[model samples]
Target: MESEALGHTVMDQRQGHGSLVAVAEKLTLEEINSTGAISNFGKPNAPSPAAIVACVPKNVHVDEVGETEFRISPSEITAAIKAGLDFGGAYRC
Candidate 1:
């Protein structure tokens, strides 16, 4: 509900504004895997955050984000997103 309300307020200001649009073709799993993250894992069901952790700049205080880091699983993220959706309205297909 809050995010939707914010979106409505922003739309009111935009009115008739137009923005640049970019389209990208769908990429195949083979193409995505060719980049190397899953090149060894076989077909990854979903990209793992840990796979690219090395790319992130080494943090001297990485422990600051300890609990919120890799410990949280994808199921938890999905559940949180679903809970937020429930606050807006009963989700109806």
Candidate 2:
């Protein structure tokens, strides 16, 4: 696997269903959006001034089986909430 090539070990495995778990050394926030952004798409009230969260190192666990799961940090969750609030504020007129 690509993760194995990157020096991550398979901490756990499951049979019957193909699944593996690995730890990522770093991660970043890619995007943020709110319901208003979706509803206002291609409209005048659409949100602008995209909020860019800079890339930062985040340690997280990655579980890949049928679907991908990311075990993220509490700080990451806080950052996401803050970003959502910012997106909502900008989404409103």
Candidate 3:
């Protein structure tokens, strides 16, 4: 959904530009009972795990836990949000 949000922003910008077009996708919060959702598709600056994952390199590997669900900590989400804020503060994006 975060990725979808980013796409929405792109699409909106395209829409604003003359002779440009973009197909915007919708965001949904389905099946998000466990993992903490920081879904702010309309706000790209928001801490979107999906967006971060999309922008970063995908060479990351973790312990194999096939077809398993996991819990997310609020502290972790807070930390990520802070890091994003800090990066933005430093870079003035």
Q: Cα lDDT of all candidates, in order?
A: 0.44, 0.50, 0.47
RMSD of each: 16.2, 17.5, 14.1
Per-residue CA lDDT of candidate 1, range 1-93, in tens? Answer: 876876754444344343212212455555554654332322236443443222323333456554333345567665765575556532322
Between candidates 1 and 2, which one is better according to lDDT? 2
TM-score of 3: 0.29
- Model 2 lDDT at residue 58: 47
TM-score of each: 0.24, 0.24, 0.29
* Residue pairs with backbone atoms closer than 3 Å in model 3 (clashes): none
Residue pairs in collision within model 2: none
lDDT (tens digit, per residue) of candidate 3 on 1-93: 876876754445545754332322232334342233345433568564553331333354447844444455667766776687566542211
Best first by lDDT, ranked = 2, 3, 1
Pitting candidate 1 against candidate 3, the one with the higher lDDT is 3
- Best-fitting candidate, measured by TM-score? 3
Model 3: ten consecutive residues of lowest lDDT: 19-28
In model 1, the runs with Cα more than 4 Å from the true position are 1-70, 90-93
The residue pairs that clash in candidate 1, if any, are none
